[model samples]
Target: MTRKTVRIAMNGVTGRMGHRQHLVRSILALREQGGLELADGTRLWPEPVLVGRREPALRELAGRYGLERWSTDLDAVLADPATDIYFDAQVTSAREEALRKAVAAGKHVYAEKPSATSFEAALGLARLARDAGVKHGVVQDKLFLPGLRKLSRLIDSGFFGQILSVRGEFGYWVFEGDWQEAQRPSWNYRTADGGGIVVDMFPHWEYVLHELFGRVRSVQALAVTHIPQRWDERGKPYDATADDAAYGIFELDGGAVAQINSSWTVRVHRDELVEFQVDGTHGSAVAGLRTCRLQHRSGTPKPVWNPDLPVTHSFRDQWQEVPDNEEFDNGFKTQWELFLRHVYEDGPYRWDLLAGARGVQLAELGLRSSAEGRRVDVPEIAL
Candidate 1:
């Protein structure tokens, strides 16, 4: 079998999501599995070159993985002709410039979203990648979750006859760092550092809604800083400038209304930290990260409304669990494999930089709606 080695310059792997998901679970796991085999039997092997600002962390991580390549200088890494892909999971404030340099170097670019701090910059990156004729993509990992995948299958099978509305609850309490250490980085709470629930999560909601239900027509949102004061990683008190919570009402095409709440301050009361309930004429479904439960019109429970009476039926027991028809792998790994195919074998890849820009656009509009106290129309984005 023919073997092709592709070197990936991975930035920000020292960060939580970057290290755990992108590096360990996705790329490294793929590497351990003897790389990805193409349609014609050619194996595509990924060699990850760690890139970050910290020397010690890079050295330690590279050494831990038994990998030889690691670098603190991003420019030198990008300039290497051997670097076939540039993957960025850096902070939002620093992503745009690094992405620009990578695109200019003619490397295939993939990055975590919000790809940039604003819609303009995200669109610029998309256009730049297009003009450079490079294969580019953004991480839309949530769409590959088992629950969402089952939900997609249900939609394809006409389970939801004329979808009406969707309700999504996402978030768990993030420690303020005063009592317990904060779960997320301190920068995530500062506005100047491109941190906010609206900017961080609206991009996720955009792609999920657009892919499953419909394109968002408009949005009305209210953003708030629930915890104004929080301690940093260094145990230093600072004023939290970014919005920790955002409540949004999104109007999707085909008359589906979606209400989603994103927060870093809310306590989780559901089975999963995040879950979406999609309602339709024929049936309804509630999907979390790993499970999806469906309630058909035939199995629907009816109850008469009474002011003072005992509940008649077990409402929670009514829905049936959707069976997993196929084996599911790590979502990040799955996407990484697909991206490799797209780059080398010319496979279909829709989640390009433009898609990333659309996410950023929704985020920008969501923030605008919150500020203006009015519903904002979502303009169609084009390359």
Candidate 2:
């Protein structure tokens, strides 16, 4: 088998998600696993060059990982003819400019969601990549997750006879950075810094619903900052301008209604931090991050609606668990492999920049709906 090496310039890896998920678990893990095998019996190896703002962090990460390449100069990295791919995990505000430069540099581009701060910019990036003829993709990691994959299999097997509605709950309380330091960065709560539950999570919701259930036709959302004040990294209080919580109702193309609540203020009460309950004509399924349980029409218990009396049926116990027949890989890593295949052998990759633009569009429309206090229709986009 011929060995093919592709150099990847990874940006903004100092951030938590960038560091852990993309750089460590996805890219480096693939390297440690002897690279990815392509369809043509070629072992496609990844050579990652760390690129970021801080030189100290980049050098430290590279040294810790035994990587030789680490650079604070994005322009120099992009100018290198050896760089085959440019991956961005930067903040929403910084993403567009960097991506534009990457596309201009004639490099394959892959990045995290909400491609840009606004729908227009995101769409612009899609157009740019399309016109530039570079193999582009977005990190739609949720679709590759174990629970969602099982749920998708159920959909494929016609387990849900006629899909009716979906209910999603996602959130966990983030500390105010006072006594307990904030788990999330302070920029997440500031609107100027491209922060908000709507902008951050609506993109994920868009792709998940579009891929698994149906395309979102319209959205109505109530976005608000539940906590007005929060301490920054330095333990200084700042007015949290971004919306901490968002309650959204989405209408899908196939007549399915999806209601999702995303927040950073609410405490988790479910099996996972994020969970989706999908109901259909024949059955209903609840899928979390790693588990899926379903109850068919025949197995579903009929309960008496007596408010004054105690509930008799074991509702939670009624659902049957979906067993994992196959081992599940890390979602981010799985996507990375697929993207690599797409770049090398011209493999089928549907999650392009346009899909990412759709996600950003949903987020933009969601925020608009909240501000106008009305449902906003999602318009189709074209280059």
Candidate 3:
């Protein structure tokens, strides 16, 4: 049994997504499971160095996870020749420049998505990684979700004979600082701070829709700041310039339409914070974070439309719940394992920076569509 360690420089891990999802849930979890196993019985162990701006946060995270490496000197770590992978979970505005530096340092690159604020910048990062000959990837965690995986299986198994449409409902009411403490960071409401519902959620929607149905050919979006003013973390009043909500219709390659509504101002009434319903000719399914329900055309209840009669049948109860027959790992960890394998073994890792650039392109065009009050065509990005 042969084993080796791959040193990874993790930047901006003090943040929520980085610390919780990437470092703790994914990397540490992998370490706990005795690392990733390869086909030839070669186990790949990850030696991750936690890099951040704050000393206290870095120390706290390392101590909590029982990790050995922690550093505030990003430049020093980047310049080090031993670091194998450079993973960035920094703010969107800072991602492009930091990534360029990482590629220049000759490190395999991976990062959180909406890789950059603009499509050009995102694509440029991909080009840089390509030119540097470094393995690269972006977090596409939704595709690895258990519910979505089951849906993919069903699709492959021909459960849904002819897919027709997809409707996504994603949102939860975020508290303003007036009464309750704001759940999300104050920067999310500020446009200058690289925040908006469109830029944030459209990327997820783009990948999900593309992987499940087909490519998003066009988008007709309407984005708005439902709450114009809100109090910040310090009880200071500020105008929310970025959009808090985005309603969009994505036209897929095969004419299958996907409608998605993303919001931070809406109240949650559904099963989860995010859910997608796919309707097909043979069957239909609704998938959430960890669960999915299905209803075939044969099992669909027939109800007579009568204004005088009260509704008798429970339509919601008709759908059968999809059972989890196999083990389901954390979505972030799943992708992390796959990426590590891709880095070590050249596995088929599809969510590269170019794919991430397409997501940014979709977000940019979505915003454009909303501003111009017209549908925007999504042109394919040349690799």
lDDT of 2 by residue, 1-383 (tens): 89999999999999999999999999899989999998789998899999999999998999999999999999999999999999999999999999999999999999998899999899999999999999999999999888999999899999999999999999999998888999999999999999999999999999999999988999999999999999998999999999999999999988999999999999888899999999999999999999999999998887778899888667899889999999999999999998998999988999999999999999999999999999999987767
Clashing pairs in 1: none
- Per-model lDDT: 0.95, 0.94, 0.92
| Candidate 1 per-residue lDDT over residues 247-287, each given as its tens digit | 99999999999999999999989999899999999999999
Better of 1 and 2 by lDDT: 1
Alpha-carbon TM-score of each model against the true structure: 0.99, 0.99, 0.98
Q: After superposition, how far is residue 127 of candidate 1 from its true place, in Å?
A: 0.5
**Regarding lDDT, does 2 or 3 come out ahead?**
2
Rank all candidate structures by their lDDT, best first, as comma-separated numbers. 1, 2, 3
In candidate 2, the residue pairs with backbone N, CA or C atoms under 3 Å apart (3 or more residues apart, or in different chains) clash, namely: none
Model 3 residue 134 lDDT score: 95
Q: After best superposition, candidate 2 residue 148: deviation in angstroms? A: 0.7
Native-structure RMSD, model 1: 0.7
lDDT of 3 by residue, 1-383 (tens): 89888899999899999989998899888888998999889999999999988999999989988889989988889999989999999888888888998999998999999899899999999998898899999999999888898899889988988899999999999997788989988888888989899999999999999888999999999999999988998999999999999999999998899999999999999988899999999999999989999998999877778999898777889999999999998999999988988999899999999999989999999999999999999998876
Worst 10 residues of 2 by lDDT: 309-318
Q: lDDT: which candidate is best?
A: 1
